[model samples]
Target: MKKKLTGKTALVTGSSRGVGRLVAIALADLGCSTIFCHGRSEASCRETARQIESRGAKAVILPAELSDPAQVESLADRVLAAGGVDILYNNAAVMHPWRDSPEELSFEDWAWSFQVNVFALVMLTVRLLAPMKLKKWGRIINLTSGIDKTPQLAAYGASKWAVDKWTDDLAAALAGSGVIVSRLDPGWLKTDLGGPNADHEPEAVLPGALVPCLLPDDAPGGSFFRAQELRNFSLD
Candidate 1:
């Protein structure tokens, strides 16, 4: 039986556990042949790979500390050597220890969030673009959070906004080039980062969250999606 994504290969970052793990499995279940699972722990990545293989898909563990430029470059080199993938899910991110306010937020917190959430994402995408552009087919889903301003999570929110801006521009640049870029706001869910107080469960992100990743060529680009719905929201 031919599946929707049978011939596709995907790189799902931060896929060791939580929503990242679920997303990787979902893609695998749909018949993605090669799934690159990124995380800090080799054991977790191995577990994710096992689960992906259980779905009859190939899983390759790609471990890297997104906060480290050298490690990120190494990861990119490996992916390029393996042949770039058809889909890139920039799901990994960091929410550093909170400070009372943005002003109180230590430089380390701001730097860490941006390094992982913003800088690493850009670096990986730029590295993968050559293959995607040449193949004339690709999907880049940049995971983001809501627009709400939480003083406690100031750096995190700001980092997400940066990605939001980046996605918007990249979507426009890739328009009509057979590659689509979009922002996916997964909403606050009960995950390691979201905590137990979150309203929804990790599974609640399914179906809708995956929608933008599988968009048709003619589908609107540069759209901000909140789960399944396209939103007209702003970072400011």
Candidate 2:
């Protein structure tokens, strides 16, 4: 049987591990033609590339420190040069160290979070939008957090909030344009950022995580999907 994304290409940021890694592999399993795995270093993405190749999909390792704007631009340049992608999964994010109080969060913390979580995401999305628009088909999934009332991680939460806002606004702008932009909250999984005590395992993000990518072109943009809620869900 043929797969869902047989002719499609994708880019999953932070795909070296955790939720990004799982999502990239799942896309490959769905028959994506090429999946770009982004990491801070090429070495970090080797395993993911191997896994994707094993599934008969080509994996390209694109390394860039998202915290740096120049690196983000370089990453985008590389992707565009490679002919862009049919799907863009903004899954990588950084969490600030928990502070005793919200007021204790430093300027650096907020800046760092915004740079990687918000600015970098926006830059990539904007740069890639043209290609998707030209083709009149695309999927943009921005991973967000359900974090709330936890002032200890204010910087992280605020950055994710910005992501939510960006998604909503972009969705509006891209409405009826054939390119759907939406948000996906992977829940608190036991990943590096989620810590060992997280409620769910990283694998729990599978099928549900791919929902946004598989949506019909007419599906509304800006929809929010929760991976945990879609557990045991069927894609067929």
Candidate 3:
């Protein structure tokens, strides 16, 4: 695609570390000047901003607990004030109480998953939809997983499945609106949540993770992509 996002603003959550961080840097490298390098820390955000700026891209820092509706609203507001969010990377997620069987997983686990995975997404999407819709162009990507079929990580899988369905529904609801909705599975990267021994590295999938966001506005939406399966679109 073109350097279409050069002047656009992109916000990436949990971008202070790992895959989210890599995506932020990658988008900057692709000539997107304004990127919101978001995390839970002022210090980390500054550090992320420094790195992006070193690459000659502008970075904004907006921090919030992804699960909190009010915080998500505030984040959207900050992005709007910064000239609206053109791309949204919902890359942050929770993998709580590992190894707890479905029945053994506490109500708290369920609540927390929905809070971060589902509710916060709805809130943020709701807030940004108007701006994106008006601009007649935007990209929204939700990071999901392939293990929704696996026995392990039952709760995490279930939550991502929710995200998958939600993304598809949103795409259908807004067909022809120019706002694209898609889901990305970053191929089980080795992060704090993915564990140290995981099969993939965060950097390995950075380019593919950026693709869904960079898809042309006329391209199809509501599809699922694993980084390994997205080589067809790689600019490299």
Candidate 4:
């Protein structure tokens, strides 16, 4: 039988490592024909690209610094030029160092966190939305977090809150438009961002990470998915 996403194209940001890299490879294995692996530099995504190809999918490396608005726009422009993607996985994010006191967190740290985690993600989403609407089919998965009450990581937590709000609003607007936008929490994993103290391995993000992408066309938008909750779930 043909795979669910056969012939579909997808873009997985921050895919050079960690959760994004694993998700990108999973998408390829599920039959996404063209997988755009994005990272901070082309070299960073080479291994990801190789893995995608090994899974029988073509990989295109697109590099951009999410902290820079110009680079974000350029990244979106390039993807649009190549004919927009069918699935968009906004998986890139940044976290500020934990400050013993929340008051000690610098404004610059908060600014940088929001710039990469929220602003850049929204910029890419809106820019690529038109094509999806026109085609009447698209899946957008925005990565969010479950961090709470940890003032030490307030900057990161606040940024994720902003992502949740934006995702909710966008989903409402796209209702009945055939473009689905949802937020996904990959849970605490032992990735660079998740740190070594996290509860699960990065590999545990699979199956659950791919859940939103495989939702039915009639599936409602603005839903929250937790990868850990679906840890033992099967796509088949």
Candidate 5:
């Protein structure tokens, strides 16, 4: 089959299931080889890789605990070994239940949440940026959360906000360099993280959420985006 992303390769973290899984599948279907990284579940990771391969894109499964910096570095090495990652989907995050109450949350809890959601995400991006810059073409999609009102999810929300701000800044730093960085809010969806009561299904993120990652090299970055539309795409 003819492919739009024939030579590209995408590394999607937390892709063993839910929205990340669907995104990986969609990228593979578009003809981009995929690298699936998921923590704690080898079976699930294998399953996702199998699906990606079945769609005709090569699949690589590399499991690494995001909370650990050493593991994150190891994963980066493996990704670099794959001839450099052209697309990076920062979809992994930690949202512990204890974070539901700020008064009851401990310093350790907050630190752990930030470690996975912010530190590791930033670390992995820093580690991988060199190759993308050298190649002069790349897409870095950082997933953001839209539930700002969740008092119980303070850590998650705050960390996401940090990433959103970082994405905005990174876009400016990467301008004219052929590397695009954008924040994508997938909206509240039915996933393990989103819970069963979320208004939309995980599949709802497709077509719309995928648009930013598919933008042209000359497209401006550091923009915010909802799954439904680019934050800066004016209808007027």
Candidate 6:
């Protein structure tokens, strides 16, 4: 059988390591010939590209500070110059130490978190959605966290809530526009962010991340999907 994304080009943000790295590789294996793996550093992004290309696929490495809208615009322009983006997985995220109480969070920290976690995502989608619309087909999959499920953190959870709302509103905004907007929570995977005690491995998140990008046109939209249970309302 043919792979789901044989001719597709996927851009997996923050793909230097952890869940992002795994997701980029999985998409390549699924036949995404052009994989754009982005990172804060060139060396890291190059390593991700190496991992993807070793599997017999072409890849592009984009070094970007996603929090900066200017850099994001440049990145979007470069991608548009190269070709169309078929699948976009907005997976990068950051937060202050959870040890800090609500009152302890500085205004600066909160602002920075939103810029990176939410604003940059919106910019990327806005730039790419038009092209996707022109073609009348595309997938926009935002990588959200389980924070909304267990909300002890402030800035992090708030940003994800914004993402959840964006996916919902974007889906409605793009109705009849042929662009599907959705999110995938890869569970509590053990990584630098998830900590060593997390329930699942980093690899477990890939399939869940990949599923929403390949959702059928009639499938549910503005919803969340988890590896253990994929049906609607199971915020697992």
lDDT per model vs. reference: 0.86, 0.95, 0.82, 0.95, 0.81, 0.81
Clashes of each: 0, 0, 0, 0, 0, 0
- Model 1 C-alpha lDDT per residue in residues 1-236, reported as the tens digit of each score: 23677779999999998878988988887789999999997887888899999988888998999999999899999999999999999999989876776688888988999999999999999999889999999999999998486888888999999999999899889988899988888888899998999878888777666776677788867788787352232111
lDDT of candidate 5 vs native? 0.81
Lowest lDDT block of 10, candidate 3: 147-156
Local accuracy of candidate 2 as per-residue lDDT tens digits, 179-234: 99999999999999999999999999978899999999789999999999989778
- Over the stretch 1-236, how does candidate 6's per-residue lDDT look in tens digits? 14777888888898998888988988887888899888898898877898889977898988889878899998888888887698888988876676446787778768888998999999988998877989878888887877754334788888988999999999898877778888888888888888999888887775567778777777656878775453232212
Kindly list the per-residue Cα lDDT of model 5 for residues 93-137, writing each as its tens digit: 778784446787677667888999999899999989999999999
Query: What TM-score against the true fold does each predicted structure earn?
Result: 0.94, 0.99, 0.93, 0.98, 0.92, 0.92
- Stretches > 4 Å off in candidate 2: none
Number of backbone clashes in candidate 5: 0
How many pairs in model 4 have backbone atoms within 3 A of each other, for residues 3 or more apart or on separate chains, i.e. clashes? Answer: 0
Q: Which stretches in model 6 have alpha-carbon errors above 4 Å?
A: 148-152, 230-236
How close to the true structure is residue 131 of candidate 1, measured as C-alpha lDDT?
93
Q: Which TM-score value belongs to model 6?
A: 0.92
lDDT of 2: 0.95
State how far residue 188 of model 1 sits from its true place (Å).
Answer: 0.8
Clashing pairs in 2: none
Candidate 4 lDDT by residue in tens digits, 170-236: 9999999999999999999999999999999999998899999998999999999999999887766
